[model samples]
Target: MRILLVLVAAAGLFGCAALPGDGPAAINITTQDVEDSAQSGDYTVVTIDPGNIDAIRSYRPMAFANQFRGVGRGGSPTLLGVGDTLTVSIWEASPDGLFSSGDSGSSQIPSVVDEHGYIFVPYAGRVRAAGLSIEGLRQSVQKKLIGKAVEPQVLISLRDKLSSTAVVVGDVAKPGVYPLPLRDTRLLDLVAQAGGAREATYETVVTLKRGNRAGTTRLEDLIDYPENNVLISPNDNILLSHRPRTFSAFGAVKANQLVPFRTKSVTMAEALATVGGLRDERADANGVFLFRYEDAELVRRLKPELAEKLAGAETVPLVYKLGLRDPKGFFMSQHFEMRDKDILYVSNHPTAELGKFLQIIAPLISNYSTVQRITD
Candidate 1:
């Protein structure tokens, strides 16, 4: 009975043997095995160094000027459309002229473009205004009243624009459809008109949809890069959203939390620092790994040999190792940027697992000896 009690206590304590960074034997993969697999073309592995850092930077997606070319610009004036209100003023040279009102020989007419793109004039009849600029419509009205009126001079101006507008929604202080002005209105102008984004600049993502085409850009980049704030086109839909970039930290890091980047880009060192760095006692200094899915085209450009192994893959799974034991590794970490959704894992020191096993069994051994003494 005494021996059986000791065996039961030992078995119960052995159940707690699993430690940090320990996994099932079938799934356990060592750092050396990862390195060997990368060398054998089973997976792409990159060492975080100055040259590789520059290569990764080259592959980083850049925000270019929205190349959506259409009708909205300074070169082309705002054309008339349905539901647009216009003010027409006609002037005559003589007091007894056709539009004489209280001897001023001028009249102000308020007209709205109809469904058929035409506006009515007393003598000019139904005149087509849609698809014509303000100046163009003025010329059309003058030509219609040429024979009837005495050398009529016409001027036209937009009173209220209703048809030509862009819809702004999501993550803004005010979400509504804003009308585009007669002059060229830009993307930033429309966003400002809607009361600006509710989130931080770095956290905001602005997507522009024009017709069937769509483009997305970071709000911060749009503000910093002038070209990204392109002219807003009619019927364009602007969506402002907050999608904060983050990366996951696991294994022997001091704090294993989903860390968010405060800026557009964060270096590996910055990410590690944000998470309180690696645990000195448990972390294996040479086993830091960053896991991410990289674009195949970029992989091909950077490492053709690895690219060949992943020919059929759209995106290649890549793991980058950083040896913190080396004095120069700290410098390399500063250059290596941590992309969104990346996983930063620091494997535990091999001896740490053995120490944990000893810790769990030591209590069981003491309990067993105490039970034996009681039985005796």
Candidate 2:
């Protein structure tokens, strides 16, 4: 009886509250930590609801598809520019004319557009070739050589394009420099010309660098949304890297590690099921938490009260809680979209904390009971 009294007193030491278990409990998130307030990281808790599921889905990570929209892919006419190699053919009606050579009445001349955007011919000197199409430049040369040669007929053909080329690198089957097409060439078309991505579209990330600005998004995003594919431009550097989306699973789950997203997206319900679900013996069903960092602009729209509080902050840390004890929570989880690098944690049950305490002191209680038996 004395030993039993001592055990009861020891259990009473943890009165009003259970012992600290694996990670913070759902109740601890909002309350202040009286002992060391600084230790508790600043974060906001958001409850998942049907009214805001669409808004949550709208704001995803690494989606710079907006940058691609309205940029590049203009159907501009391809003209002869500086560093362009051209083949000029000149024909003369008389054999004694300047362009006539032996029995042949025509002579072929290889020329290059100079830095000043002008090309020099045998009879026509310093003709403006830049910004002029093959047919347009041909007419200009013929007009210039009208009096110099005997009925000179000038023909201009683009031998090589030295400018307006883009570089394709990383994860692509053919990584090299390619000239931009005359017609409208979008991102997908440029990628196709490079022999496509070596990795799966869903598993690859496309990074486009244009001048000083650059944007990154999943290759799958460009494939799924045509508008986001945008247009390809000269001097644009494209890179395709393998970046499989994944999230970390921690706390009272069956397996504690990083879990990969198999499809284009994985919801909270799917994420939980991926790791064999929460542990029935140890997990607190009411304390399922998902930790993420969202843009401040999005947070202001979702939670209007936070507009003034988060000044100049780009991203705000948000902890989303879902209580499975409520029958509607299961459905809410289905609507809750998970982003890359999200953390899915299940808090330990209060009863489970007690069980752990009991396990630790079980040998001590057994030793005391054996002593009592020996004394008796």
Candidate 3:
């Protein structure tokens, strides 16, 4: 009997020591600690209420598609530039005109625009072609040949484009400098010409760099929103990149693992569901937490009152708590947006440790009693 009691007591003590709270890295945190942490100036603790939900939703980054709404569609004629090749056809009304060739009274001249932005014609010296539209250049040549030729008529068209080219590189199968078409070329047109993005649409990010400004949008957004497929300009640098967004699930969950979102946006409830939901037997319904670092400027815009209270906190490491004990908490989870690199943790109930201790000793006590009765 003494041996049975000793064995039972040892098992109980071992189980208690193996509990999560007794470890150096404790997984269990009380509500008091979460609330006091903010007052202690250790970290910001945001209890997700209706007001907090509104603030967080308001501060989330706007859809990449929204930034491209103002981008204009392709319709404008392409301007000529230096290093472009032009094919000019000039016709003379008279048989003895300067440009006459047998009964045709016309000549086709292929000229490349020089560094001086001018192209030379047979009788019309050097005429400016760069920065002028095809029709504009034709009129300029006709004006020059008015007295030199008999009722001169001219037609100008782009033979080749060398100076007006855009660099389409990064995450593309055929990345290179692509020439801008005579008609305005839009974003998707250039991408398609370059063999499209190598990565999946949802995982791809497209960045457009024009002069000193740069803008980024998801490739899926460009495909879904026609307005986002804006016109591409000369010398624009286009980059396609793959950056997958993911969140980590830890503690008391069905399966603790890094979960990747298949869509551009995902809600907290959906993220929890993806990790197989919480482990019902061990999970503390009131101790679910989400950890992330938020932008200070965004916080200021969304939660000005809280922003003022945490003026000195620069890194803005925030912990958002949700109590699933209430039925409405599940509804609130639907509204909470999950961001990249976020940590979702569901702690175990305090009584669960004692339950575990009991489980470990119950079988041992039963076995010990059977042995003692047999010996008696």
Quick one: best TM-score, which candidate? 2
Off by over 4 Å in 1: 1-43, 58-78, 95-107, 159-161, 181-186, 210-217, 224-231, 260-266, 295-297, 306-317, 365-376
* Candidate 3 lDDT (Cα, 0 to 1): 0.78
**Per-residue lDDT tens digits of candidate 3, residues 203-236?**
8889988776577877876776776777877777
Reference-based lDDT, each prediction: 0.78, 0.80, 0.78
lDDT of 2 at 156: 79
What TM-score does prediction 2 earn?
0.79
lDDT of 2: 0.80
Cα-based lDDT at residue 362, candidate 2:
79
Give the true-structure RMSD of model 1. Answer: 5.5
Cα shift from native, residue 57, model 2 (Å):
2.7
The full ranking of all candidates by lDDT, starting with the best, is 2, 1, 3
